[model samples]
Target chain A: MWGGGADMADPALRPIQRDWLSKTLAGLVLGAILALACSGLFARLNTAMPLGVRGQLAMWMVPPVWLGVLGGVYFFSSGVRAWLWLGAASAFVTGVFYLL
Target chain B: MRSEFVRIYKAVHTWTGIVAGMALFIAFYAGALTVFKEPLAAWASPPVAGRMVPLADTPKLIAGVLAADPATARDFTIHMGDAEHVPGRMGWQVRDTDADDHDESSVRHYVGTLDATGQARIEASHPSQLASFIDVLHRVVGLPVDSDPNRWVMGLVAALYALALISGVVVLLPSLVKDFFALRLGKNLKRMWLDAHNVVGIVSLPFHLVMALTAVVFAYHDGIYIVQDKFVHDGKWGTAFQRQQPAAAAPGRDPASMLPPLELIARAQAFAPGFEPTALQYQQVTGPRAVVRVWGKDAAAVSPRARGGFAALDPYTGKVINSDFLPGRQSTPNLFVSSFFALHMAAFGGTAVQWMYFLLGLAGAWLFYSGNLLWVESRRRKRPRDGGEVPAQRRDVRLMAAATVGVCLGCVCGISLTIVGAKWAYALVGDANAWLLPVYYTTFFGCIVWAFLQGAAKAAVHLLWLAVMAALAIPLTSGLAAVAPGLNMWVNTSLSSLGVDITACVGAAALGWMARATARRVRQGGADSVWSEGPQPCLQGGVPGVGVQAK
Candidate 1:
């Protein structure tokens, strides 16, 4: 009965889920970098954009990075693993930004 | 792990709900009333004489008032009371420097008419005491006579409510996806009650959440002292306020010099770009280093009350010294905090938002009522012992029934009486708001006590009927006094009063419906019958003094 239950079967698939989580995190990081670069280029092209509007656009950077953490958890094998990955990714990304 | 998470969340939800439920009930109820604060205020205040002062004349009128009462010029505030035609007026409050004591004793010093030469004449109208009373009720809940301890008690209750909501959401998570829209009716009383509670909770979850969180913030503003001390005062806990004091005050010491009000307004406009200056002040007026402060509205901001920018002008020269708009980066936290207020108060998107909040508020009220009902129903399955000696089950029944009828109907009675008190105060003393608010609240609390003494069924029926009558009398009283015709004329010309009358009519209808429903329930259930009378009680009688009986 325990073997037939969804709970027991879920752990067998954990390794595959871990791989998916790592892939998703990598994709999100790449996407964020590209988007930031594009926004910088767009701002250079459009000089008339108000300072407030530019600031608002810049604030959009925080939410996406936060969302990537959540996305990584959703694809992970377990909540603990998901949290670990999220913490690591967040630290690395935040550190990179701080260094820049 | 999942099960453990669920268990923790369930505990949180239950405790939070239990603690915060009563305060949330009061908050949501009074907040619903506060939606019409402006109209209610107008209804409380007497009609103003003369046409509304022209926009152009406002500055002149204000100037005249300041010149006449030179003492008031130090620190003063003006309110543009309502719009024209429907008793719209203007008033001001000036600090009474003449007082011997150092404590501020500002008086409601009115400036009525601006003469042909643009001079102000003193005018007096009663303050919207009823609306203000309702506002206090919405905020602190404990009126003056209720004892000061009630405020702290309510604050603690609010915090508990936040906890309950969090715990509730946690408990619901496991079953949420499967039974998101589940509402099984017909038999299985416990299941039915659970379904009802869940449905109400989930449907109005967003509103309830925002309201709970913001209410906690408001109730526990003192908690911010921790953050203020750490972040605001260079890591020093108690000295934050002292540090900010110098910056907040006037920079210069000029007592004799004053800036041209229009120039200050113009400078403020320059800072905000599109915003109109709503208020202006000259700080340290007579000194050589006087500064003019200009404050105004920014339509793009989340709330109309959100202070956009400040422009300080050198009073003697009319030169702009500081032009500062709230920086977009720094404004994010403020925007988030204010968005909570806007969401809770339905002040952001105007009428549509107000209606949405009203519906949500009603739903929240229903959620609490249903929750209590569920508790009663769950216990009702266990039958009380036969005969005169009160079984613990029976006592539980009586108390829950009393609370259900007393608190809910008592609120209705209180609000209705407050309206009546407003009218009566106006009729008898000409200034109704002052006395009407306290009278209505007294009547409301009396109803609660009255409900407790009587059986729940009887109390419910009586108060429901009383509410219907009171609500109906609102329009009738106005009509009989010929105020209705003038009110109708005003309603045709103004949306505010029309909305007020329509809301009153709707309230009358709702009370009438409640009366009928209570009467029907009384008829079906029979007089003196307790809610917990059947077989289901036996299945869940683990608690002492409660027992299940065979049919």
Candidate 2:
């Protein structure tokens, strides 16, 4: 039944019979990591900076993160590609946040 | 199964967007301007010197006033002026129970200045009518007081806005990536509108979502009360609401003592280590057991809502009774609420955040405007020449166009005119708020009527030009009215006036751009006739050559 249904499934999912599952899982992991990192940075800024400056940072942080993620998802060639790009971007943002 | 869910969400998104788009646009546009309410209020008041008073004198003056009137002492609120945004004046409201056997309120303002002993002295100034007018507009969108209908309507609109936002996210899930950074300008009308909508929606999605949700929260908090009563509290909504209420002080019978004001202040400071006390309230001043309430501001707090780190002190003994810190269970939610407020008011970050929200708000407004245009464009070719046999769809489009242009641009012009009217009213009538607030609504309604008659293209062009011209003239008008010599001196002396003038100039520039665009459209002869699939004469008897009779 699995094999029969597989034929009707998305073409993009065919690669998931082997290594693609790991990548998809990794992408999900990366997304979580980035969300946490950004949230943490926001928290720190809220506590460390002046109320006004923190507010400004929050305004800036919200737009880019939300837009970037949404844009990456929509503009990518395929669902898998979208996920991969999202993962990479998330990881990169997380790394940048850590450094800051 | 996944695709089925996606399709269902898409339908929901479209319907929600179409239903709530116009109302959301109005809310956002007005709300963005409300961030600078204080500055706007200041702009309305004429510049006056010797407004600032020493903090120490506030307590003594308050004590003296309370000593004279026993009832005023029980429930009193202090008004502190921001140096940049507010005039240095201490205003108070006293509730007189003796008059009419009910609470009769009186508003008195005192000019804050230092005396020979370096203490703050109180004197009266003219009442602020302009500020109150702006406040009403910001809170109620110029709704008539007699009609309770407007509140429910506004509340319903806020709910619909939330629904629309949710639907928007669901719809964008599919194409969010392809159009993420894609703001392809100067293209097919539909495509351009779609791109613009997507970019603005995605960029400001969180801000918009928070705004929509919180607006509903504010407007329909009563709904929550009802819900909690019916469901959460098992028919005890009143009790739940009461639980959230401030605790009343227990009655005390000890003899009154002369307490040092400095001792109370010192105790309050120690209670909230990091916060600065903005106001100190002595409850039942002559009574034996008086409660001194100290309201403090947290330096790291983003909004006024979050700055309420309070301490209640025993006036005579200089001992702390109670304090309000962010509760553990509610800290996150409270902070979220505060941050949302901060973002909405542009109070968290300085000018940069304010500018960003302002720009995005304008873009969001445009997005709604374009969305309406797109809908009109889609039906234009199919519309009939005569009013008779008009399809419901075409009628809907016409109404939407009239309303969208009328209300949005009308609000801009109305608000600007209100500010100017406020100043004039202050100078002439001495009570600007009474006449000025009415003028705002009258102008807004008049603009709507004008838009309805003029049609979208002409109304858009004319209003844009008028607004631009009016805004640009504001600074010059203000300067001419000023007794001061130079613009710099005016700005330095009165920050509120300066801010208003600068804002006016910016508003004028924006309107000018809009005016130019509208003119180009007029010159192009109504670029694409909505009624016809092909290019037809602008507004020349509905879709030409389409045989579809009006439904």
lDDT score, candidate 1? 0.55
After superposition, candidate 2 runs with Cα above 4 Å error: A1-100, B1-15, B47-53, B78-89, B94-126, B142-149, B234-276, B281-293, B302-312, B315-322, B325-360, B380-396, B483-492, B530-551
Candidate 2 TM-score to native? 0.68
What is the CAPRI rating of model 1's predicted complex?
A: incorrect
Query: In candidate 2, how many clashes are counted?
Result: 17
Model 2's CAPRI class is incorrect
Q: Hey, what RMSD does candidate 2 come out at?
A: 11.6
Query: What TM-score number comes out for model 1?
Result: 0.68
What is the C-alpha lDDT profile of model 1 across B322-430, one tens digit per residue?
5433322125534554565566666555566667777778778778777776666665533344644333445556666667667766776777677766766666666
All models: lDDT?
A: 0.55, 0.55
Error of 2 at B63 (Å): 3.0
